[model samples]
Target chain A: MTAWITYVVTAAGLTLVALIRPFLGRQNELFGVVFGTRNIRQDQVGRSLKQQYLIETLSLAVLVWGGLALMAWWHQQPPYLALGMIAFLLAALAATANAHRLSSQYHQQLAVPEAMRVSVDLTQLANEQTLSPVWGMVLLPLVGVGFALPWSAVAWANLTVGLVVGGTFLLTRHLAANVHGLAAAPGAAQARNILLSFLLAVAVVAQGFGLACAWQPAQAGLFSLVFGLLTLLGLLLLLITWLQVTRRQAPAGAVRTDNARWYWGVFYYAPNDSSLFVTKRIGVGLTLNYAHPASWFLLLGVVAVVATIAVLSN
Target chain B: MELTVDFASTVPIYTQIRNAVIQAIADGRLKSSEVLPSVRALGSALGVNYHTVNKAYTQLADEGFITMRRGLGAMVAEQLPAVDPHFEAEVVPQMKALFTEAKVRTVDRQTLVALIDQVYDEGWHH
Candidate 1:
């Protein structure tokens, strides 16, 4: 009877998540640039992998737990439950992979503001349109640090690097905040924010990895406690800084701007993950709808590390 | 000073802010030279748009509610200008309705309280 109840509860939870996924999916709507000949928004390009299988995320979670419960009940081998979990996950991931890159590209093209256009051809991809090779060249190192820093120490170096790099990127962003620049020259800001987000993600992931490693085997319990508190502090600082920079942009986009100041009010990017993908962009306008998902994974990583340590210590 | 903003409302946010500041002036809640909240400070408070508030201050300068020059932000009007005493009486109730509306769709008090608690514990505001 208890097993039946648990199964029912899991099914119910999955149903709720499936039903609610549409709304959560819309949160990313604010991202993506719009440069395609046919304008596209982040939300219009079909649902994200998570949204498409809203039920999948929930159902799989339930299945992992419920299958274990049923295995215990029926005296079945639990390893098969694990195998089933892996199978469902791999299939879901494979289905969603490489599905919407085209749509995001189109959105990025349209996102370019009208005044900032260096090139008139809306149909061109970023590479085809002549961009300042110097900008791309400069962005290479930033992107390199972002993608290559697998180890925590290399990530740590990004703190000072972030200040210098983010400051430079932010200066450009502030200057480019107007509709003229956003519409006329979309990729410059896109290029910079993408680089900044990537670099920050590298640093944050490094920080999370470091914290996880800090509490490893037989470290005094006090060490874990101190490290946990410190991790929490670092997370707070990152959040505050993120808010400050984004808030600087929010009011300009507020609908009530005096029409005279509309020139100054033309920024389109959303903070963090809502940036538009670059495929569809014309050249200008900021895209804030689709940020790399690495940050969420990093946060989850921290939680997973702490949870694992708790379970292991037990 | 408590500040608030509603993005969805039909009224412009700067106008809403101007009303808040003007109401404070009329109510004796704001004494002369009592230093109105800075644009960034109040923007965070109202959660409305900051540019709207800055615009309001600029308009108030045009209307003589306060004196402002570049780099020197608006301060309360000196020597309290002659104004209708009943002006505030007409404004307060409407302002209350606006506040209620702002609060209406916002995350409820308990949720905001929880967020505040989390901010305190996690130091997210810092």
Candidate 2:
């Protein structure tokens, strides 16, 4: 029963992230396709499309949950559970991609080309908007305590938690330092700061879960409830942040409508663009400029780290 | 200070960056001893190569408009260097070319002088 509950909670969290992603950016961008703010936000077609997308996404989530429940009823196999999880992710991605296609069709009808100009403020360049990375130091003691816990046999689990926390810390710092916000939009910076804080919270929650693993079987239910509540609160916070950010005024800087620079309506690729990281159009945080030379190195480093962790975990 | 570069312009990106910095300094938007953004930061922000920004900084330092120190980034010099023979040698030909163009365009000597005064005053006294 506890395992079933865990599966449900994890599925719900994943679905929630998928549902909220479309609203993480300015309302002008729908499923990664850029449209005029007024047209996209106020047009009847745009409204209907967004409604349709939400309905489809929710229905897909329900179907995935039903399938998972059916699989659980038929057999208590670990591989079946993994299959259910994979199905949920694939379904969510397909829905999002369909939405993107619909949005692109609408954009094509307009036939308007956006300026490719990028801008930066000299006065703001020196200011660091991200939270100090020193705050990551708070996790070290938790990790140390985790190692000292009675669950010495699960030291690998504790190390995994530490690795996740440490990895995210470095990624957040890199994003904060490298990402360039073209317009002087306070909303963008605020959204980024919120994202940074949320990641820290996630890291803390992972630590809590690791420590909870050492608890006696009788206390397991209590820990699960507490963790579930914390996860719910974090998702609520994320939703609120997205709503606030989406309602903010659109960026008044250079209109970057060059569709050729984007791949599959989301990934930004411009070989001439010097920016290593650009503010994300489809999401709340930063996305890499694949054209930058440093992006390859960063990608390689991430792959190497993940491979190392996987090997060590085994 | 805000820097803007026109990518469509025929001027080289490095030259534009150098000119912008000098113009900011002349207009007093950038004060003496003010530190500039790091080359990498400014380059990424402007969507240009860091080497381009480094070239601009090198030119500014050579011209004695800014000083680059190890670990300190580029800073506006406390005192701009006095005009040297090398600078004069570079400036006279440019001034002569401008005067020749003005003369060919039938601009009177007084009008040219007045235009120079107005520009100098606007740049320095703004």
Candidate 3:
């Protein structure tokens, strides 16, 4: 009964993720947050989004059904659960890459209008404060200690994951300081606040997981349930914040320009742009300028790091 | 003081930044002895290379518009430098070009004069 319940729960979670996949990294209509190709119509965006959803659903179904078949054939001798997870992660990465490529192609097809060709005054962004160095002192010590502590493998893994979550929160704060140049603008500030809140919630949940793993491994099932609930809470908070930001009316003199050109909705390229980093058009994050040589180096470095992580994890 | 640079303009970015700062000073938007944001801070905020902002700051410092002090960042000068002899010669042509464009566009002399007066009055009052 417990095994059957686990299967059902896992399937439900995968389905939910597949459904939500289309919405992730999508541009908000009102805020102009992500890849700002105003020329791309909503219908076109919806069509591509739907296509991405279908691909994700198909990939997930293959992972679930194929894994089940293999497990049944082999009588679960080969640890089917781990294989399934690996397959799911690979599928997710592929889907993301595909979606980005498609978005960029759509952007390339759109006509650049004369009105959208405007210059932005970056001076307005100068008033906003950067991430405090104190956050570094707070987060890095925990990560370092987690690595140094003599703990069981599972406990250490949990702690490491918590540290990574905390690290990501700090990194996001740093990136947010640099990307959202117009700090005084209502939309920009609200977006930053929402993003910070979401990261904080996720970090807290990760820390809870780490603590549970360290103190109560025998109650793993209970801990998993708690983790799920906390993660859901974090997701809910993010959703609510996103809605608030997207729905809020833009303030007067908000920075608007068509300086950024997308290569495939994934890579940003602007020949005239002096900065290497630009605010993503589709999501609340920063992206690189493909036109810049340093950006290419950065991309290569990221790819190498991700590959290393994947190999090590496997 | 509010400063803006148009990334899309044919004019160099550093020059635009320098002009904006000078304009702000002339318009009294930036008061004497007011501290400006550090080059690194401004560069990060503007999403530009630090060198670009540094170039602008250096030019401003050379022109006696602002003073760059170690550890203190840039500060607006207490008294601006006297206008150079070539200042009028350089400015008149630019002003004439604008007037010529306005004339070609059929803007009346009275309207142009009124516009100039309004701009001058706003800057003085501000």
Candidate 4:
């Protein structure tokens, strides 16, 4: 793969990962609460699932490039390239399997509430039991295609657009009125921060300038500069909002200081250092964990951009 | 990570964790050989019991969804037989129960189909 393709793939992959990492965490957290919380229900679970699928597609944006890098390094031996691709497949398979198992453990405990199958419910659960084994089977073809692409700038752009659009759209739904009511509450600061984060996500993608590097244009450079700067600003906005309202702040609305808030439909269990052990430590009370996937992804983006600019200037 | 289960819901907690992890892996957040937190850590993180987390991990291991070693911790497992134990063991029976329950209530097949269709559409997304 050309250097630019690799960079583009890295960029797309990073962006998608950032948006998706927390979502998966949130989803699993919900799964964990499925049985005990007769009170919890995600009105947006299907939207979240579709969003996950889209982000997964975008992650494949880099796979093709990685495969090409392998081929380039060992072009004389197709076998070596094939081996590298196989390893990638195996690893992805393992990860995907584990994810489903996590979902299924929750599924068995799921009562399929009388209300869940309503027109507004999740279809992914339609085949809940049959879904587990089918998951790995479904991912196989995508894994193959990921190995097939030659990994170019054009492919990178397509992947980038898909990743950004899909992720932004999903994140947007979290703010789509009802979903926010759970975590954000109506009038509180948590809601405010989440709302801002939603807009910031949209702001990042609306910039048509791509990564503001390889796609920069001389004629439209001034316009690109404004938008590119705005995109960076949006990232800063996310960081600020995350830091401000998300700290051990009490939520608002029907959820008072004494009760757990239901933001995004999933219930946020009340804090108790010594409660049922799991309830005490789990949930979204700690939104700023350093090792969170999105944290790593955001760091990746910052480092990659700085390194890319540094390399070019030198 | 071992899933801290909530057994009070319509679905089990481990299933919830499994779905979330599946989504994560497909999205590329958790890669292969990436060490998952111990079930204890996950339970503490999610605020569930350690036993609940173990149940999830063990179930996943059973279906070849993940692999576990005595001290090495749980990792994503690979390429198992294409058998959907979930669907076979759970969904089909549920569907039958729904239908049987509907029949006992004297609901027509069309109503049943409509309910299923509605769920397939907006309900699924909700």
- Residue-level lDDT of model 2, residues A39-108, one tens digit each, is 3766677777778878998998888877768767778643255566788878877887788888888888
Best by lDDT, which number?
A: 2
Q: Which stretches of model 1 miss by more than 4 angstroms? A: A1-58, A62-156, A159-161, A164-314, B1-11, B67-74, B79-126
Cα displacement (angstroms), candidate 2, residue B44, comes to 5.1
Candidate 3: TM-score?
0.63
Model 4, A209-269: lDDT tens per residue? 4433334445455665576567667655654554354433332312111112222222233
Q: Mind giving the per-residue lDDT tens digits that candidate 3 earns over A138-251?
A: 434434545565555534554555555455454444242222224223455456556656655566566556656656779978888888888888777776676466434332
Q: What DockQ results for candidate 3?
A: 0.24
Report every candidate's CA lDDT.
0.42, 0.70, 0.59, 0.42
Better of 1 and 2 by TM-score: 2
The sequence of per-residue lDDT tens digits that candidate 3 reaches over residues B1-126 is 556666568988788889878888887777788778777656645556678889999999988899999977788899888878667777899999999999899999999999999988877565
**What stretches of model 3 exceed 4 Å from their correct place?**
A1-124, A129-131, A140-186, A200-208, A215-221, A247-261, A268-280, A283-314, B33-47, B67-126
Worst 10 residues of 1 chain A by lDDT: A117-126
List TM-scores for all candidates, in order: 0.29, 0.75, 0.63, 0.28
* Order of models, best lDDT first: 2, 3, 4, 1
- Using DockQ as the measure, the top candidate is 2
State each candidate's clash count: 57, 0, 7, 58
Name the lDDT value of residue A106 in candidate 3.
Answer: 53
In Å, candidate 1's interface RMSD is 18.5
